[model samples]
Target: MKKFLGALALALALISPVAANPIIIPGDKNQRLIANNLYLTTDSLFAAYMSENLEQRRLAEMYVIGVIASSEGESWCGFKIASPDAVQEQVYIGLKSASEKLPKSRPAAAIKSRLKEILPCKK
Candidate 1:
């Protein structure tokens, strides 16, 4: 359908790959992976910013609940991040996801670490 094609085109145009299955510092056990590419329906880059902000905020939601919340909310931004050689291609990189899913005690901490690599280096 025309709609489908248009949608595909829009997606390719805006989103560019930044990181893919990126391993955070401290080795595989300690590090985490981030979904580089993001897709937005309307808000575009602003939407991505909002999602990242929320993911950063919910660092202490605690285990399961936190992961669920992050998964449902904009934190993941509707994208799935995959781990290295990960069976599940749909990866969850939210703070809670990072904490619960990663080896680290805090997913938020893991996310921040990933962001350090993601965020443009300060001059």
Candidate 2:
């Protein structure tokens, strides 16, 4: 038992640093650039969703919905917010409206603000 404990401690000590420090590959920068650019405009967002894999598309759509839901409430844009499907549609329309109204530089903020006019839920 003593030998086993000593070996375990040694193994953990050796592995700890490697576990803590992640390796930054060269492509990580490019990936980050692409992701950052995705949120810059509704066109970019929609293009990425259409071009990326199904999982990526789903995540992008979910991100749009989450932003609207979080900024407002679950009952976003004056929609009933009854189910996921309904919420998704409302989010899509809101995003579309925002994209048309907002400029490219501040897409997220513009979208949020545009939503106020497009779908201001009565308190």
On lDDT, the leading prediction is 2
Give the per-residue lDDT digits (tens) of candidate 2, residues 1-123. Answer: 866865675456445432221111123333443333343456445443444356546645655666666776522453453455654565566556655565244445544665665566767
Off by over 4 Å in 2: 1-26, 29-35, 74-81, 97-119
TM-score of predicted structure 1: 0.21
TM-score for each model? 0.21, 0.46
lDDT of each: 0.32, 0.49
* Cα lDDT tens digits for candidate 1, 1-123: 866865564455435342211111122243332322212111122223224444422322223243434543233322234323221122234333443354324433444344343332334
Which runs of model 1 end up more than 4 angstroms from their true locations? Answer: 1-101
Best by TM-score: 2
lDDT of 2 at 108: 51
Q: What is the C-alpha RMSD of each candidate to the true structure, in Å?
A: 17.7, 13.0
